[model samples]
Target: MEVNIRHARAGVTIAVDGLAELRELEWHDGHVRIGAGLNLTEIERRLDGRIPLMAEWFPQFASRLIRNSATLGGNIGTASPIGDSPPTLLALDASLILASREGEREVALADFFRGYRQTELRDGELIRAVKIPLPLAPITGFYKYAKRRFDDISSVAVGIALELESDNVRRIRIGLGGVAATPIRALKAEEALAGKPWTKRNVREAARVMGQEGTPLSDHRASADYRAAMLEQALLKFFFEKSEVVRG
Candidate 1:
């Protein structure tokens, strides 16, 4: 589509769907390696609910038509700040397997994006697969705020993976999109919540830090203030939802 719309130019385009090696999916060394060639639909079916965060993310990404054709490699390759996959993958502490003539190397998703529409991929390197570490977090949530509930781009997207110990936060990872030049982890917020009691006050403080984590810009989709508000609300919402689940 970028080529058709003249947004991207390529002297030649090579089809890679026929590369069987790039379609292999397997679990090894305590991590699941998902082939870069697998489309979102195929990924969802293959993963089932093993990865709870991604299980909740798939349905909210674009539409069925888009999911059927969009591959994980392509999504990560684009390096779009608003791309849905990055945030979720970041929350899961995923990494990319970059392959080239020389050999293959893994790059953490957090370090993959260098800037807006830029990545660490070398000239000859291609993403072969995505590796997600095993033993998923106990509490996970994905929140995408857009003008439309379905089939719309997000103005703010939050992916969270958290572990709680005796009502205190053992660990937490927050991935955010549409609020910076690249998808980023809310490190400061995580620091604020770490080892703190999972109470309204601690969460509220961390929420404030999260809202200020990224450098948001006002765009047609939403105002910068609105994006910040959503970030704050997303964390609070997740906490409330999980609290309700525990109460039940």
Candidate 2:
């Protein structure tokens, strides 16, 4: 649509919707392989709540109409900085299977993007599938802050997955969008929280680190400071929500 609107020229466009290989969903080796051609709507229906973070995210995506036609491959391939899929998938510790005429290679989703709107997808290659390893993080959350509640681009988006040992953080992954040149993992925040008690003081410090994870830029949707503040707030919100769940 962007190409048509801009009257841009293209060499070729290949449609893979009918390709059986690109449309297969398989569960094997303790991981689910999501076919690249599967539409977002189908993915949501098929996965159900198996991937909790995605279940929380799907509705907040563009909308039913847009999701009907949007595929995961297309979403990730575009490498849009504000794209919602990247953060959720990143927190899941997913990988992409890239296929070319020569062969196939798997690349960690974290390492797939090189810059704004740039991906590691080589010429003559396409994302065959996304592989997410099993035994998912027990606690997960997805948050998108936008001007409107629905059908709006995010000002800041966050996806988080965590495993806890008693009250201590066993492992945690935080993925963020709309704050940098590419979707990124909150590694510093994760480091600060890992192996520590999930207490208010520790989380507060980690949240502060999260606020500084990406180089946020001011745009029409929000100010740079607001975006950073939201990053901090999102983590804090997740902790509170989980705490309430435990209390109840």
Candidate 2 lDDT over residue span 1-248, tens digit each? 45877788779787896688878788786899999999989999898778888999999999899999899998899899998999999999999999999999999999999999999999999999999989899899999999985799898999999888888899999999999999999999999999999998999999999999999999899999999999999999999998965444
| Candidate 1 segments whose C-alpha is farther than 4 A from its true place | 4-7, 245-248
Q: Report the Cα lDDT for residue 78, model 2.
A: 89
Clashing pairs in 1: none
For model 1, the local distance difference test gives 0.92
Candidate 1 per-residue C-alpha lDDT over 1-248 given as tens digits, one digit per residue, 9 for 90 to 100: 57777688888999896598788889777899999999899989988888999999999999999999989999889999998999999999999999999999999999999999999999999999999998778789999999986788889889999988888889899999999999999999999999999999999999998999899999899999999999999999998988865444
User: Model 1 misses residue 190 by how many Å?
Assistant: 0.6
The local distance difference test score of model 2 is: 0.92
